[model samples]
Target chain A: MAKKAVQKAATPARRASDAGRAARIEGGAVVVTGICGRLGRRLARQLHRERPVIGLDRREFVGKPKDIEHHSIDVRRKKARELFRRPDIAALIHLGVMHDPRLGAEEHHTWNVIAFQKLLEYVERYQIPKLVLLSSANVYGPRPDNPQFISEDAPLLGANRFSDIRDLIELDMLAQSFFWRNPGTETVILRPAHILGTVQNAPSNYLRLKVVPTLLGFDPMMQVVHQDDVVRAVRLALRPGVRGIFNIAGPPPVALSRAVKLLGRPTLPIPHAVARAGVERLWRWHMTSFPAPELDFIRYVCMVDDRRAREVLGYGPKFDLGSTLRAVDEERWV
Target chain B: MPARTALARIGDVAADDVLPFMGRLWGGARRSVDELAVRVLGSDFEERARLLQARYAEAGGDPFGLDLETAKYAVMTCAFFHRLWFRAEVRGLENVPQGRVLLIANHSGQIPIDGAMIGTSLFLDLEPPRVIRAMVEKWSQTLPFVSTFFSRVGQVVGVPENARRLLEMGEALLVFPEGTRGISKPFTQRYQLQEFGTGFMRLAIETNTPIVPVAVVGAEEQYVNLGNLKWAARALRMPVFPVIPQVFVPFGQMPLPTKYLIHFGEPLHVQGDADEDDAVMEEKVHLVKQTIQSMINRGLKQRTSLFF
Candidate 1:
């Protein structure tokens, strides 16, 4: 009967948002934000070996670790809302979004949707029982009528033809309207897909270039994942009764010319209107960092369906697609 | 920088000596084109393409890409138009059962060569050799080598969530639902039947599958189309400008060998309620379009000559 009147008005709004706040949601201090990103410093060195991490980032956390607490401010400062006036912080993650394309579209919409809308208003005024966000599978874009896998209820249309992915699809629609106006904060979001390793994204800098190019008669079917499997799908979306929007994807889909012949490089091809007019004249002569509608991610099928993160956040991908395309030639240091 | 590591040691010695001698001369011209496709598809067409490439390499492949060696050279070029240009003659290939069925055909020629002669008679006369899949036109995934040869030959993108994930992976799909309106009708609306699309009877009543029907009969006289220009198919954004006067001659763009036949029928099963009412899925899509219009009127009354 209308799914039992939507489970009788969703069980007293999920038991009045799980009653009193003392369910610690796995004890204190995660915070993380853009903790000097290389995927926010490998998710703050694996969430500081199990909680109490903090970091936030205006950049300098370089070799950071001594019991991690960095905080170089500006997450749109008022001294970054004084570290959410700590109520033992347990989970805010956000992975500080930005994505450069040589910055200024008004500093990429005030650092990606006004600093993730002031960290979702300090994760809804610090009732922070977990939040996550990471947000990507390129906001559902590389289309040509998608559906090869797609599915986290599909439509974001990745900023309809890449208007510089409009603030990461408006910060994944402001973490899906703060996951419907915070039913007491288990937000989640993730999205994943083309992550790949040694993070300088854009499919790990188009599989660390030295020839790559493609699109001539477009190959498509892509997917990717492994930035330590998006830090293990943000540690299973900070666990405690997992929240929504999952998508994470990793190994299965391959053919963008067999992932550039499984990265043994050598590609070139061109002609999608001469590689979108030579990557839009080498991205307006700052000499290329891609963006010619990101060559419709090598021309189409965006790829996703991580079977609801392997049946609800038990997630999967422990790397194999030859170590997730050899983590973009790991440690290719200068 | 020491001349960029001596031009990365001569681009790593021409990627270790000219890409493995041009991948061993492209693997000896792809093993002499799979030995000229097992001497033109016979001697048990390489054990039915190695049992359908070990059933899609034991499922570690075909995540809607298929590539069983590009579907064994697109079933050796549609088994040369199903054995020498539409000499097709298929008939009830054992009413095509075995797992997750559907077929449902009747899309006339005008081009999908009766879906490549019913996917080359279920990959060259059935018995443990299925393949089929079909769907396509989601703007042929925006073209470029017709979307990588329709995803390495299994073909997909006519979404109802890719036909309920190729009928939940027990495969054999095909469909047609008279899309592109029965392959661009006109030759005085050939064997009639056009309006089908109840999205494959709500994907065969939401995946309890079995539908079959098929009935091809010489792809409605191959390419006779005589009409549809629809303002030059809306100024060339295409989906039907067909007016096929044997495509302005020359090789007349091939088609008319005509003699196909096909048929199949039997399987049906079809119970109801896949979110019911569209006048009950158009009366079970008019009982599978009146069983493919009485099997294309009993295969055009057992045809004796259309080019046979």
Candidate 2:
């Protein structure tokens, strides 16, 4: 498959006329894990236009595509060697790191880390040449000492705040270690900033809330990317000759207070200690939208430098902070 | 004891009634002042702003989100401080280049009134009116409204990446290489230069930016920082806790009005390996520190009194 990766549909890097330079998928099958996800659905559809795609997940995807084969099997419990018995699976795209609040700590581990390890085992057994793993920028926990644009070299510090997201850090290490160990396989780990579009709009939800409670003395810098851009980045990562970890954050980071003001929402300032205590209680009562540890994100800067993604994958974000905020505002109003 | 007294006072007057009155009074004054500022900026101000926008075209901040209407009001407010409050006199406006340059100044006083005055001078005194992004201390980023206020006004955390980005975007960056040591030094040590951190020098080399040495006087006389309480700083996780007698007095916490004099030295273009030894870099950084110190000494020699 001689595919020149188009990270975003409207990337200024790749003009419409130059589309001839990068070829689309011609032969071989593209295996997409967690096909039920909104991202997975779009990715499968986009990839399906070129060649055959096999989507593996536990439940059937909503609005299942006719061009793709939907395999309803839990990758962890089942053997993928049977499915790839003929051995034509070109790549495995894992988009299954679900932040479902209902899942307990143990369930999250099984769903995230264990499932990822199981998939890696299958990749080696099945000889999948390309692998793409999606990780969140939150893995680089927001801290007072964090650099302005945290490089990919920065340590995974999420375990310092929330025990729940510790698996994300472990998953990144596993992927990186696998990349180093295996000489044949090409692994791309994308640590994207806050994803705000469709279902993955946690930041938007928090920003849109009336009388949003913010840590009184802290306002973290926010770097968000549109869902379409994230999809585009994954496409570029899936392209041949692109490897190694990359930070995928869109530019013009806005302060949390400014984001709320842009959304026409008022903020309720609470002292850090008091807010932490209140959020802990809210989490205990199951009255909060997210876990208590979510407060730390708003309290410090978790911005990532996405220069590598732009340089290596030619992934330039189409939507900046202001445009993204306007989109969020319109979405909320409607 | 004050809590009981406040409750008794609230009990005497209906809480709801007093709250509304206070809110109405405050809101009315704030609205009129902002409106008055907008009006005072007058007709040609908008035109000038539109012209200024084109200059910052390459600047990598939120272009839609800058709120220049608010920034204008802020610049006007700072202009007042620059003209009336401090009676600041700035020299060598021509020394500052139109494009990227690093303004290295001697940091002074426990409070950062000096940095504000320098910013005000650049905005009001210079042609093209560059919106210089002041690199802020790391500890300040942890504070709530302060960080937001700083960022909205185009301030960023004092890190290599932030400075590099701003400079790369051809922004005029203001940095105090002395950092906390320079800003929080005791009153007795006023005007004396501290050991300059070589990071700025390294950054200067890396980005190929011209270094503009600045000296600010009279800020040291703002608040009498008798000394710093080290234990309190450690406990509070704050960088410094300066013990000033005025802090205990009623309505005396504000810095005393001190006339400020800012001098901009020649743009020193340094070229060397940023990866060289710290000792080698210190030799280069020492020149910048010395330049600021001499300027401060000259300004102090010309000063007549602490406050008018």
TM-score, candidate number 1: 0.38
Q: Model 1, B162: alpha-carbon shift in Å?
A: 1.7
> Distance from true position, residue A164, model 1, in Å?
38
lDDT (tens digit, per residue) of candidate 2 on A269-300: 89988988888888788887777788888887
| lDDT tens per residue, model 1, A178-294 | 777776777778888888888887788887898898877878878787888888789777877677788888888888888778778999887799888888888898888877888
Report per-candidate DockQ.
Answer: 0.26, 0.36
Q: What TM-scores do the predictions have?
A: 0.38, 0.82
lDDT of 1 by residue, B1-308 (tens): 99999999999988999899999999999999777666558779768878888887787778877787777877888887777787788878898988888888888767787887788788878887888988886777777888888888888888788889888888989988878788888888789898887888888888889888888888778788888989989998887788788879998878888788887988888887789878879988888899889889888888989989
